[model samples]
Target chain A: MARLEETTADGRTLMRQTPASAEAQTANATLARKMRRRGEESRFWWLVPTIYIIFLMLPIYWLVNMSFKTNQEILGAFSLWPRNPTIANYMVIFTDPSWYKGYINSIIYVVMNTVISVTVALPAAYAFSRYRFLGDKHLFFWLLTNRMAPPAVFALPFFQLYSAFGLIDTHIAVALAHCLFNVPLAVWILEGFMSGVPKEIDETAYIDGYSFPRFFLRIFMPLIASGIGVACFFCFMFSWVELLIARTLTTTAAKPIAAIMTRTVSASGLDWGVLAAAGVLTILPGALVIWFVRNYIAKGFALGRV
Target chain B: MERTWNNKAWFMVLPVLLLVAFSAIIPLMTVVNYSVQDTFGNNDFFWAGSEWFDEILHSDRFWEAMGRNLVFSAIILIIEIPLGIFIALNMPKKGWGVPVCLVLMALPLLIPWNVVGTIWQVFGRVDIGLLGYSLRALGFNYNYVNDPFDAWITVIVMDVWHWTSLVVLLCYAGLVSIPDAYYQAAKIDGASRWAIFRYIQLPKMNRVLLIAVLLRFMDSFMIYTEPFVVTGGGPGNTTTFLSIDLVKLAIGEFNLGEAAAMSIVYFLIIMLLSWVFYTVMTAYDAEQ
Candidate 1:
């Protein structure tokens, strides 16, 4: 009777195993097929980026092409490439004092502006990030309002104010003027980054008996180095490209490249070649600066924890 | 933790305050002075009361310019924001392609605003400009210089080309920060591609989109240099927004009082709108 019972149980187990094994195999096969399809779909994802890069590059390619060509060639009908590409346009720019002076002036003010903005912004950002004061949110919003003010609205007033103060035609004047926008932006960006840092670090530093300033300078600053870099880069770019206030504030001594570029349009007609060359030159400093800071930009936006 | 409230922290903010005051406050005071007074020449002034403000507020020209400014800014925001988001979505996220894509995307932004205008100016010339020449060769009558419609189109297109990259970069930054786990979860749930984008990507992009919209709106509203360079306010003020008109009034026409009044109104609108944007965005972020 015991032997008969064992045989019946074994037979039932086999019957159950057969269908279960078949179902398992079918599921495995289906998953493999779906994954293979996904791999194929991902391959075509390359098309999206490829088209996007091409779109981005076309205008730049056109600009560089124009920079290489002469006035006559530029005025001539569309050519795929410069027919008689010469460095004469570039030469004209490098040799011209006014053109080179614009660079020097732009660099001086941009640097000054960056320095002023970043230094001032660092503490304000830290305060906002670490401590809540009276009307902190209101103050932050008020700072942002300065950035929103139209540059055109400020043009006549800025000129009048600077002239009255005898600050017009000075590099410092333009640098100070730019702080109206840059400082707030710098503060905002830095605050975002700083807030992401864990409070425990500050506490640990205090436990080590470090004073606030020392801890902030030696400890906190390095942690937020990428944020500072990104902020400074933006400050440099904005100050460099800005024309309205720069033009309005300075007639000769501190005239920026943008202002100088405008002078190319005279009764004689646009100096297309030199203008193109200058335009190309104006782009160089920003490109160089951004290239240096490109690695930090992503990190800066990561809000420091990354 | 000693959470001592240090008023000395105020010292840290003082430099920025001073600099901003020197630049913004003094200039604003001057604007106030100009708005209430009339200047004929040689810096001589007379108290004009609310006459300039009345004139500016009543003038059809002022209202027209404001209308144009509003329309232009709206069009720019509409075009740039979505287009920017789309481009950002497609940008390469990894590998050797990343640097190349980034550099290419940044090229337009690196170019000075006036230079961008200059490039478009040359690029849209019917004779030499590739775009204009190509269009003409293809048998389309496209001349931005003489035709108001063409000029407006060219100006708008140039702005898009120049500023769209900004939105793209901001949106790309926002998009890339999204964790991969979210996508994996969506995939496991068998979500449609559209569902993934709608439920995951769009919501994630909201903060940056808010930024992109506000920035594009303010900047486009204040746009002067590019249009000024490209068309010099056009074949008869067709492209003249408020800034252009303000410049024309203040410098070109030498009506300081009217210009100042107009500028004050312009300033207020921008400030009020920007405040609204900030408040709304902050509230939204807080709720999230």
Candidate 2:
């Protein structure tokens, strides 16, 4: 029987060795202390990531500072922070239809894309992880190739296809369009996570007389909850930030925030403060998503092997 | 873990297949159709056959853009991968710092591509932007608009700032998954710092690093909006990457057939290179 226990360096079985020898116990304690000391020695290296993060945040900080100031103030002076900080830029975005509607349109499509990608991916990922079929490797590779295809290559064709189907300027159009890339990604990541689960779990569930859907939803899903979260986060992130296809597929009704921002450079010139505020608002949803999925984000990055 | 042979698995994958086919295949076929036919107006297309392909093949402009793309991807990979790894290695293994670092690092990745371009475009402006203003104040002649060298550096630096966090996040994920037991084993064996990284961390990080390299390569190769917003491929055609050039030709000039041919060629190059990288990396991964 394979007991659920982690073995030590010695040949003795960890679960059975309840009364371990004093020598072995002492050795284990000292080994742990050594590891702790090593961790302490490396603790000061935290400064490296700190400095690097400061470098990363400086440009963003400048943007936030600029957003709070008037356009004249932004162009006239180079202050570190806004001397006369104002929320008028944000007010302009909140009051404007073209601006705020961009957020609504972006959210609708991104959510739809996330749900669709993750739902379709779960079954396919389970299939890839637990079973083999005809042309499985080819199918998997082909799906990934879609991920590699540049959005620019598809821009014209996508415009034509969506317009032909009369999907132009609709949320579902961009939502379905993003599936080209997101579905493959969701499948790949979820497959990695699923492969980490033992096949015996599925077999055990089946032997218990549970149907596949019940087993998957009630048992397998909760097990790989982080994986699902990671997949959804990625799908959301990709769909949310993508502008080329969204720009191509939408004219007015579903123009994304990113596309709307581009129109800020009008005949009058760029609206620096308002544009910065919109940029800041655009970052908000992703930031919120990242915060919610922070743990899974790291686990997801590890491809859920851990 | 051996997967069982089950033809019935097709049922599980059907939805994905249908969805992807609708989004991918139809459009790809259309691109193919356009590639072989020359369209003028009124939906009139002449049988151009391979003439457009031959023209694109012979065009010096296409070759130049391809060359620029290759150099840009190479430079980005060389810089971001190592820097990302180094940052990940030094990151706090545990504590409040982890979430703070991860979130802050991820801020750039979440920003839309065009906004990222705008941030740098404004940030690098001598009149209002902090970076350009500070540099000029320090008596340096820095301008991304007129100077090709400055444009290249700004673009490279902007990309590094934007995407290194991705590599860093991936590497950090790999780093954390490594059991403390491995570090303990290395410590007990009196391993040096370099040996610990060489035999343990580096090998552990190989999978995520493979992903980082491939993603960064493909994305950087397809880069358009950022440079387009900042330089407008400016000061001349110094930064007009293949995608931007294709867009200009197809949309701006309306040479649909020639642009479609160029797109196909561009797609083929990416596909072939990605296949090579994937096979080589995954093969090496399996070996270890």
Candidate 3:
């Protein structure tokens, strides 16, 4: 299923030669390319993934198409595209305080959670990667056990705890609450990336009269920039996408857009167009983040485990 | 890489330890506390002493829900794993197609879980949805809201649409990292296509596939929002997995003690299964 591209035909025949040394590595590459190029599998195989992608996009496309149509057009017929496209649904979200505030509220807590998770996770991850502290293995595994804990189990407890602290209906409450799941994940991923960096760098930095904090900030932090980006992206994605805990923890003031969406089924009826617009809008922030980190999606997100 | 034995590293980890404790540990303790005590409204409580646990274990409802959760997770893993590997294997190795595929494939994943549920809900409506309308036009009685079989199919397909990208991404990462020399040596040996995949690709993909399977298993086991939004655990409780049942018990019916007992047992089941998976896979990896 892998695609191989040949830049030139010059090395095609040399690919048949038996490998002997460093040059053999290039010959090996050439042979691999030839195997791929000479395979009888038709290019029609590409259609499998293309068709799969199209299938994946169809529902999302429907969501986007519905967002552009009036509610009448949506319920009136199953049109593949909007007969008359209008941005009225989007206009509703932009103009209404309740609608737009959901976005702001979601962003505020998501960014807060991402920052808090990554920040606390950074030092913890470094410690795990660089040292075998007391109960390190057990502590590491216990952190992961939190990741496996269903939010359903914590939904009521979290509400009670946060309310006791008078943090109910607040963004920080949701942010801090999300740290339960995100912090463990951040630590795990970051530790994987940090372990890939040799210990010699830390020793050398210390020898140069750099204090631990300064050396960690100047040398280690930059070294794992991609890992941090990946970790932040994951933390952002989880915090942003999470609904049950966020819904339980907040009421009106800090309600997430996902929970706000439930209100679409009001006294009148379901606002399919407006709800679709909100759904499409939710995809935007994540899409923008993914675009910036697309280059790292394949590498950093693998967490160096693969 | 060797790690130094420095107990002082705990200082660096203190902040996370405190944060997770506040978030995870305390709430967990509350669940534990509630599990052993029966409470009535107005903050009145009585000692129950494992009564909730005994009742939950003996209850047919809890057992039924556990059975449903297991069946759902098993089916999801069976379908998603092979399909994810196939899709990943088929993906373009390089060029512009790579980024385009990655972005479009990941779109479903980035959408909120509830939104995914909502999308499927609307998309499966016979009156307004494309899939429902098309299926009706093709002369199949495909109503998700009212039919048990249809509801199961809709929920499973929704999960697949939502999560298959995660497996694909992980497998693709494993695929790209394979050095060209491995494939070259396979070619030099005149290995057949199946032989190449079995001997070269699958082994290289072991670690990522392990992560994919474990994540998918745990997440599928605890699934709530998407199916909850779609089916509301309806069609005569056919879709009511453990989380859905637990929520109904705790929040809807206010059976806090039994719910808490069920929660601990549910969590143990996940942890035990995950440990087994991790141990078995790592042991196999070691032998390999």
Candidate 4:
């Protein structure tokens, strides 16, 4: 006899007969098993995520801790929190155009990349979802291969390519370069969501005198708006977090916050407090994004295709 | 699931093709061009004809970095995949623990990769940082800057902190898809705990686990930003991975030919490995 008590993820108890089993489970045994499971459930299962989350939060807490203290306090002594917390670190970022502009520069390019990637990816994703064009399968695979291409591999070439176009140190250069991976990702995700929509919707829209563009925008897009949102969130996330290609593609004018932070680490004496503050600020955009798409994140992390 | 054979569907794909060509193809072509030729000064090029590739293939530096990357990926995969599954299994099925776990766990994944490195670099500092200070007070000779072993541990821990959430989320997604009836059946059949897990939950999580493994391998193999920011490939090259070594060659030393050659090799290796993994996983999946 085999006990299947662990099959359900949440450890709920129920009984059914498998073909190979000779006899049904006894009610007494089932009751006993249920009691055991309830005991097991209450025996600190929540502590797993609780402890894991505490581990995850500690480093972030340290960063936040350092950000609030003065540089003197950071180096002078160690305290669990701050002995004297100040907004001076944040003030430095807000006041210094060089510091504040990094955030602006990062936002500008990230938004640009998200818009460009999603805009172009929409039609492409639609084609992949609905059509059997030449080399479609191969083309889809080829696009994904680009996502796996390391940013380091493209860094030098991207610099030269953008320099050739007189686009070096422009927001568009970073945005376009980031499209190398983001466009493919956007297409993959949007394609997954589009395929889930029934084909009859498209046929019905088209038959109702809805031209392709109008249908895609007005009728179809609204149907898969959440997919679009998920795609935009991912594109934004990747472009925002990525530093190598973005750092390589721009020098001063379009320098991202990441570049600025690195430059501070090298160019000036270390300003631990301000850097910590900048680090804390960078987490905000992504946190906000995840909060909005919290429900879709699991599916999004799976690229929405699963 | 039938798709129409409309030749005009090509028009819909045109934008992506053009954009990708502009971004990926042109730059890649430039790298290929540089790899095949030598340049001494401005506007001077002569056919090197795989000479750089030959040199890179024989160089210990290239091989050592590749070896480090492979080992690093292997170690992280071994640590992360099981840990992720364990955490996912213990996660709350419903209620506030759901959102709390999902959001907080996903936090590190959202942070800039560079910042993830910086967070560790500071957090591990012996002077002002909690982790380093605690280790010092506890009388350990823990210093990442001067110690190779410590550096590797810091990098690995940082990676776990940043990315284990991905595996957990993916596995949880897989776990939630399983119906309750299967558990009831297994219970009635008197299946053992290990037997139920081995036969049921593990099988259900197979697809996502495959994705998690493949993704974890690829990302960890290509890992550069976080480790670079943390260790700067320091402590006598103990931490230098392929990407950092390639960057140092290409940008730091201005060794374009070698770097470009190494780039092509690196790209090919990932493709081959990923292809192998994909085929193996899909075959295993089909059998079950």
Best by lDDT: 4
Each model's DockQ score: 0.37, 0.56, 0.59, 0.56
Across all candidates, what is each one's fraction of true contacts kept? 0.40, 0.67, 0.68, 0.67
Task: Give, for candidate 4 chain A, the lowest lDDT window spanning 10 residues.
Answer: A1-10
* Native interface contact recovery, model 1: 0.40
**Can you write out model 3's per-residue Cα lDDT over A1-306, one digit (the tens) per residue?**
011112111233344444568776766666766877643256676887899898898888888989999999998877999999999999999999999999999999999999999999999999999999889877887787888889899988898899899999999999999999999989978887887788898999999999988998999898888789888998999999999999999999999999999767433446899999999999888888787766555444444354
RMSD to truth, every model: 10.0, 3.5, 3.7, 4.6
CA lDDT of each candidate? Answer: 0.77, 0.85, 0.86, 0.87
Per-residue lDDT of A128-176 in model 2, one digit per residue for the tens? Answer: 9999999998798788788888888888888899989998999999999
RMSD of 1: 10.0
Model 4's chain A TM-score stands at 0.87
lDDT tens readout by residue for model 4, B1-288: 579998798898999999999998998899999899999889699999999999999999999999999999998999999999999988887688798888999999999999999999999999988999999999999999999999999999999999999999999878866765566567768777777679988989988888888889999999999999989998889999999999999899989999999999998887787576656654784676
Name the runs in model 1 displaced over 4 angstroms: A1-44, A76-78, A295-306, B1-7, B40-42
lDDT (10s digit) by residue, model 3, range B132-153: 9999999999999899999999
Q: What is the lDDT of candidate 1?
A: 0.77
Task: Tell me the TM-score of each prediction against the true structure.
Answer: 0.89, 0.93, 0.94, 0.93
Q: Judged by DockQ cut-offs, is candidate 2 incorrect, acceptable, medium or high?
A: medium
Query: Residues B1-288, candidate 2, lDDT per residue (tens digit)?
Result: 788899999999999999999999998888889889986699998898999899999999999999999999999999999999999888876678888888999889888888899889989999999999999999999999999999999999999999999899888877776765677688889987778889998998888888788889988999988998889888799999988998888778878888889889988887887687668766885786
